[model samples]
Target: MKKFNWLLMVCLSVGFALKAQDNSMKKLREETAGKIKNAEKDTTGRLWKRGGNFGLMFNQGSLTNWAAGGDKLSLSLLATFNGFANYKKGRHNWDNNVDLAYGYVNTTSLGTRKSDDRIDMTSKYGYEIGKNWYLSGLFNLRTQFSEGYLYPSDTTREFVSKFFAPAYIILSPGIDFKPNDEFSLFMSPFTGRWVVVMDDTLSAKGSYGVDTGKHVKSEFGAYISATWNKEIMKNVTYKTKLELFSNYKHNPGNIDIFWTNIVAMKVNKWLSANVSLDMIYDDDVRVFENKETGVMGPRLQIKEVIGIGLTAKF
Candidate 1:
């Protein structure tokens, strides 16, 4: 009888321990599920998110008695602003972006002159049609904020462009493939492009595809654009956009390309470094000269800029 009682006690203890362990596992599973659900809810709570960064950079130098040959009392200044507004809800998504930059430089030898100027804006609207695909429309505009000049000599300057003088507008109805938040591809078989040279002098010269004395030139084209924004590593972010267009009304074989890229690195709060690259090629816009031939013709244009200074994020 004693042996039987001892065996029964052992069996009861084992059953109690097993039951306790099963209850603990069930509780753990419930807590984990609750956390996951809350996280998802929090992520989808906001329908619109807007943010951007602005930067101001400058450099100054003074030389009273210097051995090397360089400018005295040189000063440079640049200001930049970039922002985006994005909205995502059930089946609709809209994105709007703007970028503006202007800069100037002055020296003892060279008078104050504009170093850089830019204005670009884009708006995209999409309605979900399939997995990772959407029916979309895009509107884009590009121009300059101030007058642009080309200098053949230190004393002689020629007018090149100004606000709305060589402006470009692109409107397209397209299909957008968005694999994720950071990448998108847009393609349109039928696109409309307008080139405007509002300035009388530039218009009279038939600049930027506008007919002589005409203020605007219209073209039908096929357009493709790819955009990507990514954080390649910690504290480093890169963004790029590539655009291609072939004018069906003009030379379908000669394609126009526009590409821009930006890389940003954060050193600390309110301090950062930025690198920007922009390239453009247009068959109708012929102003660049071939140094070897001394003939004016269409050529690839590239500009690269690097800056390090104060940054503000919003």
Candidate 2:
């Protein structure tokens, strides 16, 4: 009878231990689930409270009749998406945006009627690092397609050799400083690739041709931009931006292109207007009198454009 009693006692102890372990596991699972649920709730709450805006724009402009008397009507569509996380009551936090723009232009009086289509896409990632400093990086890609006649002044009147090309792919890593909530300044120094594709006749000239596959050239450049946001009325705001860029070619003797400056203004977050001035200073041009006949000097060209567009935000 004692042996049977001992066996019963052992079995009861094992059962009790198993029951306790099961209960402990259930409690742990419940705690973990609660934590996960709370985390998700917090994230959703933050996302709902953050402010975001989207916009689109279209514009048209032209220059005086100088060479081809060409007039251009350009239509642009832009979309911007931004998000902010960790917003404090009086402090700035992490913010980022993605910008996309599509543009189409129809040109009249340039030999044959032509159209140019362009797409510009940029991804900007930024984070506030300190009281007045921010770190940011941008990836930018621009492609242009143009179909028209080549060299209208040429005696040969063949008009079917133009090709489309990738205009630019730029990677900019930079920093920003915001002195106040209303104004910010940014700068980036970078090296990028600028490609220009041309027809077989132009490529055969050796001055503009693709070496192996496609036409590609490396360039070094820097850009500086400033933005200001001001609230003029209860629900109205004005934004302005100034940007400048400089490009240096590998061979300094070649022409150097510079976008002197660009000024843009936005009113009530809807209508935006801009003007740009660009110039190419060619150092390789020869200005001398012919040995037999008297000639002239070097010629300089300047290009300017003014644009106005409308935007919608959601």
Candidate 3:
């Protein structure tokens, strides 16, 4: 009876221990489930939206004494990013956007050279005033990331621009018409624009409309901006912007123009292609050679880039 009592006691103890362990595990699981549920909840609120895309592209070529002479080894790489965040609550709305791109190419003979570089950003806040109309204030910036050079020949290059050598800043209080999610038009009677050439070399040369030996210039202008973004078809999207500015105190009839376009085509979940075109004209910036006239003066500048590569969206 003593032995039997000992065995019975030990079995009861084991059973209680097992039951305690199971209860502990069940509590832990419940806590984890609760945490996961809370994490899945939208903490940013329904009025806010955010998205972005990033791309990396590359090209490579090798020629081994073929009939057509070419570089023995050639490689190029390009990276790009575009992002936006928007908030709309009641009569108030705010929008922020950013764009960045850089590219370089290397060849057996030409060495390495910059092929593309850009930086653009914008922020706007608005309050609804009437149907499809809002009183808005906007801020914009444009600059470059690295040194730019003009290649007069395959063996010679002249430094033209660099980081902050030519930076543009614009601020305006405007009326915005936003009819839908895909289009926006903004107009301001008076806009403040600043052109900055921070580099000593570029400042002394009066680069980018800045006065010689001066670092900055201020101008008041009338500004008009229009933007459109939409998915035109399945897996293809188009985005564009057009800007017009006229200096009120200077040659008002000589309106400056800036236009940009981007087209993105989604090939699959991880592959993509893109094309971009940009044009700019400023009356005071006189350094480009006209293709037709072959003269260095104020000329329309156009740039285009096309690439196919890997992409990520978030």
Q: Which candidate number has the best lDDT?
A: 1
Highest-scoring model, TM-score: 3
Candidate lDDT values, in order? 0.93, 0.51, 0.92
Per residue, candidate 1 scores C-alpha lDDT tens digits across 1-314 of 99999999999999999999999999999999999999887786577788999999888889977889788799888899999999999889999999999999899897989987999999999999999999999999999999998899999999989999999899999999998999999999999999999999999999898999999999998999999999999999999999999999999999999999999999999999989999999999789889999999999989888888899999
- Model 3: per-residue lDDT, tens digit, 136-210? 999999899999998889999999899877888999999999998799999999899998899899889988888
Q: What is the lDDT of residue 172 in candidate 3?
A: 99
Model 2 ranges off by over 4 Å: 1-117, 145-166, 179-184, 193-214, 227-311
Error of 1 at 292 (Å): 2.0
TM-score of 1: 0.85
Which ten contiguous residues of candidate 3 have the minimum total lDDT?
A: 38-47
lDDT of 3 at 238: 100
Candidate structures ordered by lDDT, highest first: 1, 3, 2
